[model samples]
Target: MVNKILCATRNGIGGEIVQVQANFVRALPAFVITGLANSSIQESKQRIQSALHHIGFHFPALKIAINLAPADLAKSGSHFDLPIALLIALHKKGIDTQEWFAFGELALDGTLTYNDNIYPLLLEIALRHQNAKVILPTSGQELFCHLPHLQIYYASSLQEALQILESPESTPAKTQTTLNFDTIHIGDTDYYYEREFPLDFIEVKGQEIAKRAALIAASGFHNILYEGSPGCGKSMIAKRLRYILPPMSLEEMIESVKLQALSAQKPSYTPLRPFRSPHQSASKSSILGSATQNEAKPGEIALAHQGILFFDELPHFGKEVLESLREPLENNELVVSRVHSKISYPTAFLFVGAQNPCPCGNLLSPSKECRCTPKDISSYKSRLSEPFLDRIDLFVQMQENEQDPKPSLDSATMQQMVFHAFSAQKQRGQSRLNGKLSEREVEEICILDDATQRILLQARERFNLSHRAIQKLKKLSRTIADLDNAKDIAKSHFLEALSYRYIS
Candidate 1:
């Protein structure tokens, strides 16, 4: 009989579960591993043999054929090392199957080592099959101990793992809920990056209009654009906004960690929102998803899912990257298609873009003289298409000022406003925030009274709002109404939403 053990792999955005099966026949004592194993996995034979010898166990002296079954699935990473080795040891030594899903890399000294794949892979398994019995390396035990499902066991060495397999039903000594943030008090914990944004919203002087727009954006996760001169607090306001944005749920925290795992960066288990600011020279492939590479990679937007994506000097970004925003900005997700396969990733993020009115960056500055010709200014503004501009829910133009120390709101005050709106959204049984309302949800939920409809009709005819823009306007109105603590969209709410349209 073939000995089979279970494991998982990081396939795409998530992962796939794999079965490692080993069968031996009376032939030459050769160890062969098959089924699309990548280079790291293919070279595991020597490491496994060395690990067994170091741990006082001998390699199976028979023709051992190790096959990763249902073999068509593409598998990668060194996380498979532990499971493959386990199958060989169990079959060769006449040990009964323990039915454990093992994942970890083996060191030549017979101890388990860390791989970045463990977090994302185990998260996928626990979510799919709760109550799973898993054996992982001790290095990352703290990272996953808070999992409400899976009964996880940590083994520090190959010798210890074999002892666990041989003696089933014995609980491992080192099992604790160290990764305990799953039940963490959201929004109140002293965060990992406590000092990320040093400046408060009150420090942003003489831009109450801009702060008002920021308030609405934070309340509803709305996409916002700021047109301002240099030193006009455009980037400053954008940075502070992340601190005041609403708290993330447990599910949002999990989604954020999984996305970070796909990139070179290690996954952070904090409830703090993501803030990504790609440089102006970054390519469209880097901004949006990339398919030309060997594997499809989730771009910055997907990485910014359930958080904020800020683009500084927005006009300097390429047209392709700007145009690609239409999908994620509206639908809240992106389907990256390759010739071989297609993968969809959730990208529901608040987008914040900042730009100067003219190429000289002094078009709006009161004290600075403008040197750029009218054509230069026109061409720079023309780079942003009307369709792209319409997707934005709020727009504010700012100019450099000497000082206005009188504060409008600090982070604490603004956070209260956001929390109020968030409470209102949830009380109304809304699964999404106001700005993310679908066309169907907007119509069904944001029912305008006769007076509100009159304001909307008058504005629609005067502005010649397109169907898409009108739909977006309703979303904006919904957010404004939520901010006012109103149960319904009144005429004032509709008018305020209309005032934010394409400012001169």
Candidate 2:
């Protein structure tokens, strides 16, 4: 007798269907599984056999050959245990086995267990197999419920699964809900912190121009660099800027959840904008996701999707590591190429970098005397290539202040302003903020008056701005105008945008 059960195998983020075919022939007893099985799939034979004996079912002492169909594709993971066991059981009981899909891990006691990659499997199953009934473990049912147009069956044990299959008409139907699987099942919510900009413009006690630049960066999602001596509150203000940024939309939230899942990060629901601070000693693979023999994982930039990727002490990082960000910074996606496959992960993050003016950390300090020579300062600056610097939209010089004052706008106040600005941008019938605007969108939204155009042209000549720098300036200026509720790009906005450019 022969029986077949439908199952799935996941490769990367996608899933492929594997038909588990069991043949009980009248010959010498031997159990075999073919179809390019990996170590994990090969090991499932023992797990399934042990689970069957644990449930008081005898192993058929016949030539039992199990074959995963489509003999070319590789099958991995323990998710095939349940389906293989079910195929053997149906063959033993002489039951029909062609109407349903089954996937789950099995305990030694025959209890159904959850598999780690079930979410992607469920998504793929829902998308590919519409008419087939899906039988997954009870614990994974909540995640699978979000998927529509499928008859889902929840199984707690091998015996229970058999009972449901034997008496399908007697089993009760389950109601489907509209809940989002991404938002549920997060173990820890308290550890997830949103960006809170507690230090306001008034609290700085000085550097009003820097405060204005910060506001523009937050409003437009533009990249900003703060270069000054140590203890200038550049780091302080940058940390707080996250709190002042606008909230994420539902689509953004979904993207964030997917990225976190891909990276195996917990606390999937993140209401606040993500602020990723990678250390100077971080590796290239950590910054950009690496591809392995089995899967490709998301890197820091992808994890910071739709949020901020902050690199403090910018020049201290490896030149190669810093330059690696050029592609993702421009394309909003990271392409990891391996010998076999090239996978692209979305990484649409706002870049914010902070650094000292010199190695001594006092080149621009008002009260401290600079100990470093001009050569040292030049060497430090040259470490960051011009191409990398040009990608930065705003670069402001922070000056040390002696006084410490209360913050002008707390997180709550700044969040309100940011929300309002975001609302205004949306009112323009475009969901993208200023920083994310395409060149055509930039030309459409950021219309400069004749006087403002002349000012930008002069700045372009005076500052020796590259083509990329000019576009970045226009985008930043548009964000500033949006922040102030201004109808057009004014000269002041252009000046504010230009002031952020890093110059010795």
Candidate 3:
């Protein structure tokens, strides 16, 4: 009789259920694992054997075959060890079978080890099988306790797991009875940073117009670009922008955590959105994700999903790396393709780029002279493609001013405005931020008044704006209207949206 056990595996940030089948045949003593499993799964034979031996169950002197059913599916990761060992143990004891989903790694001493991938896999199973019960290492119980629906059993060792399976009246797993939406509210919790961020907009002494642009970007989740002289507070404003951005909801937090769980980074339970600032020297593959052999991994853009991706010194970044962002910027997702596999990941984030107006970093400053000729400035600006610039909603040019100016909108005040805008978007049933609206959604939701339409027509005719640019302008204007809680787009909204367009 063949013994069977249930397990789960990864399929490019997604999860798939797998069946482990064990059989004892009449032949020379040998252990074999048959499937499209990689080396990580194949090496589990030794770990499983040792773990069983440590628990006083030696394999019988017979040929043992373990088949991971649906064999065509490729299996990777060390999580196969626990399920394989359980199947073999039950086979040796002539025990029939029980429907249970098991996933973990088995140490040589028969201890169950935790793997971070369980969160996503278990989440998938919970959705597909509502009454599913999963057995995992005790260390992971707290990590997934927030998922109240799934029944999760945590065990410390192989001995404990076997005892629980053998017992007729084992205690049921503990679950969270009450949701924690109100506990540790986003308004009360600090942002997810290691240390206190002492740099606030107040520290940025000048460029009042630039500060206004940053506030608007945060309120609507719009992408913004800053070009000006070095030390003109471009990067300073970008860094502080995150502090004033709105907090995430429970659903957004879960989605963001699911993406983070796919990467090697330890998952965070906080509602604070992620902030990723990849250096300009990063390769295209590193920023946009890649597939090697059969394993597909997420890149920095995917890591920054549902958060902020700030690029300082934008022109210094690789051209290919910058261009690769165009698709994700428009579609709110990234698709990475290899010779044999393709994987898609969420890339919805607020982009903030800062760069100097020219190579000399003094072209727009009145206090300094720009040594670079017009050709140098033109070439520097050309590094950012026209299509790429179109995707960005707001463009501000900053210059060094001799007079010190007081900051108008502080972080707390700006965050409140963003929070209000977020409420408006939620009431409208938009699943995404205002900046990520599709063209169809823009047409459906962004209704322009007659006066606003006239202004839009004039701007398009005078600037020779493309159809795509007009669509983007409508989305931008919609966000501006949302900020003011307006029922319709006014002339001021249309004019403000037009002012952010590219300047020749």
- Number of the top candidate by TM-score? 1
* Pairs with steric clashes in candidate 2: 195-243, 196-243, 197-240, 197-243, 395-500
Query: TM-scores for all candidates?
Result: 0.93, 0.84, 0.92
- Between candidates 1 and 2, which one is better according to TM-score? 1
State the lDDT of candidate 3 residue by residue for 1-504, as single tens digits: 888888888887778889888889999999999989889999998888899999999789999998887899888888888888888777757554447888889899999988877778887887788877677888777676766467677788888877766776766587654343333233323222212244577677767878878877877788899988888888889888877776665556667777777877788676557888999988888899887655677888998887789999999999898899999998989988777788998888999999998999988888788899989989998999988988898999887863355446666666667777766776777776678888788888888988888888988889888887888788788888888888788889888888887755
| Candidates 2 and 3 compared by TM-score, better number | 3
Specify the highest-lDDT model's number: 1
- Ranking of all predicted structures according to TM-score, beginning with the best and ending with the worst: 1, 3, 2
RMSD for each of the candidates = 3.0, 4.8, 3.1
What is the per-residue lDDT of model 1 for residues 162-262, given as tens digits with 9 covering 90 to 100?
A: 87888757684443333333232324331122223466987888888888999999999989999988988999999999988876665567667777777
- State the C-alpha lDDT per candidate: 0.81, 0.76, 0.80
Q: Using alpha carbons, what is the TM-score of model 3? A: 0.92
Give the RMSD in angstroms, all C-alphas superposed, for model 1. Answer: 3.0
Shift of residue 424 alpha carbon in model 2, Å: 2.9
